[model samples]
Target: MQQYRNKLLGKGCCGTSYTQVTEELQELIFNHVNREHDRVNEHRGSETNPEELQELIFNHVKKDISQSEENRGNLRMTSGSRALEKHKLPSFKNLIDLIIDDTVFNNNFLQMMGGMTSLQSIEIFSSDISVNNTLFDQGICKMLHLQHLEIWANGLMGTLPWCLANLTSLQVLDISYNDFMGNISLSPLKMLTSVQELRLSDNHFHILVSLEPFFNHSKLKNFYGPLPIQPHMSLKELDISINSFHGHIPTEFGAYLPMLQTLNISRNALNGSIPSLFGDMKSLVFLDLSNNLLTRGIPEYLATDCTLLQFLVLSNNSLQGQIFLTNFNLKNFLYLQLDGNHFLRKMPDSLSNYSLEGLYISDDHLVGTLPRWLGNKSCLIDIIMSKSHLEGPIPLGFCQLESLEVLDFSENNIIGSLPSCFPPSSIKQVHLSKNKLQGQLSDGLSNISSLTTLDIGYNHFESNIPDWIDMLSNLTCLILSNNDFQGEMSIRLRKLSQLRLIDLSHNKLFGHIPPCLNITIVTTAFDFVFDSHLVRIIPLREEESVEFTTKTISYSYRGRLLAYMYGIDLSNNKLVGVIPYQIGNLVGIHSLNLSHNNLTRPIPLTFSNLKQIESLDLSYNNLNRKIHSQLVEL
Candidate 1:
């Protein structure tokens, strides 16, 4: 029996050589198998017993015969370790579903699954599957019970197999992100009436098709693909973005899908005016048709019907005409972005009444004064109307809004001073640059402790720097360049601990540059200049000789390296004092514009200490001596 043990476990047990086992050993093996089967059956009730358990035990004995045969094949192929032989067949056959994601496939074991009939779901994603037709033709079509199919392989090409349409129980179909090239027809999916959600985004499926048949499906809720000429029947949500569909939106399209709530048709070549019939969709809540060639005025009827609308984005289009809401009811609206359009005239007055928290209406041809009613909106927090053709003074009533935080009215033709009574406490940023506002800056501006940024550059403000301007300790950016402000340099400006940017260029300011001014702490592009009128002050030498010079005195201030300060410019001033050597202590200066000034003596050799200086413009100055070679190296 011991001699026969080697032959029984070795090759050819089921073929030419059969090693008979001893009766004593056979009885012992039979007793063990019977006891294990009885123990497993005891746990499982006889009514709903797992029939695969008995088959698994029988298959375990059959594995020994199959493994011996595999070894014979390995020996015939080549000489190697017997234990290293490939598995020709897998014993476990009760697998109802198998999913291998991002793995390699072995052909030897997969070919033995010809008897697997219970496989209901098979997903092979991101694997090294062959791109040949023989791979799909093997036994994939034979899995008749497969209802949920999702394949993410680069091998699938040409037309999909017709047998896939036979899966009547299929509820969700997603065949996207593949290289399947050909005209996609839904005729095969006609039998799959139970399908509820179909996603075909990012595919080569082009050409418009009438999806009228899918309208009758009771469970169909989501249909995402190319837009169809005929409307869906019962769809609740539809997304057809990034398609080449052209022509006008159907007028009665919303009539078919009364349950539809979301409609996205952006990034298409669709033309013509928005259909007025969209007002009939009482259930519509979200509508996005941006990035299209749609022209004409926004449909006035939509504003009346879409009372429940929360989000409406129609930017980046050729939409023209004034915004007029005759019967608009946007009380529930939270986000309204309608920028990047050719809208003419003024913003609709009705929009000011809405309880909007975020509103974007920039980059339009809108021409008119900013409505005073905008300040009345207590709920508005972020209001951006930049790059518009707005004119006239900002409404004084804007001071009434205590909730307003971010107000950007830059790049407009707005004129007149900012409202003196404007509530500066709630404002964090005020962008009133590139306008024609004139008059003295309000002294009350310094009282706004919450004010961080105040940009009033490119205006006609004429007056002395307000004494209270330094009271705004929280101010970070103060840009008042290209104005006509005249006075002695305010040394109190050094008290602003949080000052990041200070641009006072092209103005009328005089006196010696403040040595305590930390230019390296500011972060914004700083361009400071002394007043041109300062050039009139003539400096007297020790001999009491009057030295007449038209050029203004100028000096650049760079801050220390460790400090978070920005560079400073005190150029074009009547400053006639000697260049302070302490000015070289600023190591973080990036730019120094001290041109057209009445400075005396040679350039400061200490200026060479500014290692971070990117530009140094000290031209047109009243310096008597030649340029210092050390300063010229900067």
Candidate 2:
């Protein structure tokens, strides 16, 4: 009967209140309770033995025989979308639980909820909900019996109500992952002494700090938001990153959150030195303060006191000074990010003691040779030191690291050929661009079939582009431009069918464009969907940007833009002869640049088929012909 009522509600019950609740429905509920009582009464008058009569009475008493609906409630359920489609004001007449799951709710449903004074718990995780005003007006403040109320991942708009203090019996109130607006306040919280857990995370609320009252309150089961109050001693984690929070961290914050194990306040507008009071916090395992305007050196306490630290990210700040002076006590650390800072120092030998898995210290003013102890850190995976001052030979000991994945030393003065022994099969992306590297790579390079991106552009390598590169069949991006490689373009390049972005510009390669250069993958800038905000807007792996030329201009592609970008650049190379008609096979390629060559021929008439071409450059070449008319269709 409840299921039948639900289907009826989905079909017709847009918004019906308790006053307007169908009399039939109300009668049905009352009859259920009355019938049970009548059955027990009739059993008492029957010709049954004492034991049978007592059994009938006992079963009725345990079943719907309580004094009220609140006492009769017992079930707790977790249902998916099927349980709640397009209904409003479905009744849980027992008043101990509400019929809640998802979708729109009108004033009638909220008014109905508020009228249920005996209702003890209600969880509403709806979609596209718009609670345009505070909950107080909805009369939820009247639910004095509610002990737990959760509204997670709902598009709940509007501010919370001070009348929430009326839920004196409320023990847990989780309203996280909603579009809740306005300042988070304790005006209502101060009176709700029974609230054991109040989760207000993943909401867009303004900041105001007045949490000193909760210092010793002991009821906090973890609080998160942009509240910059002194942390409570029991709080374990605080991740208020990716907000518009400004100003310095609370001076005595560490003193309050002494027991916190995780703290991520990154991507805010915080400035000034990291709090020295952090020395008081020794239990920290994860601390990320990156992408802020923070200045001054890292707190010395992080190196000396927080030995339990596992991940420390302080990137994209104006912080200066060496990371540590001497005794670095972070032996348990696994990942460290200090990029885009002014830490003008050498690679600290103290780092070798920790079995770190990731080290990103790029775009700094550091000076040193590749540390030999890198081989000792068997867990090492990524090592990005691009645009630094580090200079020297590729350390042969690096070859010993079995877990190496990304090795980027681009824009540094690191010289010498790849050591014959320095080829880790696990390597995926290698960016040594704009360096002084020259000479032969080890034969072991042929085995790295997993290599996806290899950008060694603007280097001093001179030779035939190695046909051995063809062995990396999975190569997606191959940028070897601005090198003195004198040869006909490797015919083997035709084998790299997965090649999406290839830049052999400013090289000495002389030959006809590879006629079979039919690259796969097609997308256009105009219609390129920026994978919705629910998209991986920012990848977990630090922002990896790639520079590619399109529309005869260099553009930096990051995030999803990089994922959908496809182009080709072979300009300024000594290539010759007619452009291949097979170039038309690249119907979805976004850019094509073959300028500054002595090629004398008409543009490929087949190019009219390119529906996704965003850029087409054929300057400084001896091409002669009218453009294909169908090309205008793009």
TM-score, per-candidate, Cα-based: 0.57, 0.75
Best by TM-score: 2
lDDT of 2 by residue, 1-634 (tens): 3554455455533322111123223211111122233221111111221111100001001222223333223211111111111223234444554434434444544555555666677665543344544345565677788898776766776677778878888877877777777755544665777776666666777675756645544766555566656557677766676678788887888887798887878888988889988867799988889999999898887688888988889999999988886886876889989999999888888888788999999989999887788877779898888889888888888888789898888889898988886668998888888889987546777889998888888888787878787898988788888888888987888888777789999988998877777465542233443322242122325756677878767787765677777888999988999988888877778888998998886877788887777888889998885666765575
Index of the highest-lDDT prediction? 2
lDDT of 1 by residue, 541-617 (tens): 00001111112342222222212334455555555555566657666665566665666677677788887776666
Supply every candidate's count of residue pairs whose N, Cα or C atoms clash at under 3 angstroms. Answer: 21, 0
- Where is model 2 more than 4 Å wrong at Cα? 1-127, 130-155, 161-179, 186-204, 213-217, 523-540, 632-634
TM-score of 2: 0.75
Q: What stretches of model 1 exceed 4 Å from their correct place?
A: 1-230, 233-253, 256-258, 264-269, 411-415, 467-476, 495-501, 519-592, 599-616, 622-634
lDDT of 1: 0.60
Candidate 2 whole-model C-alpha lDDT, 0 to 1: 0.69
| lDDT (C-alpha, whole model) for all candidates | 0.60, 0.69
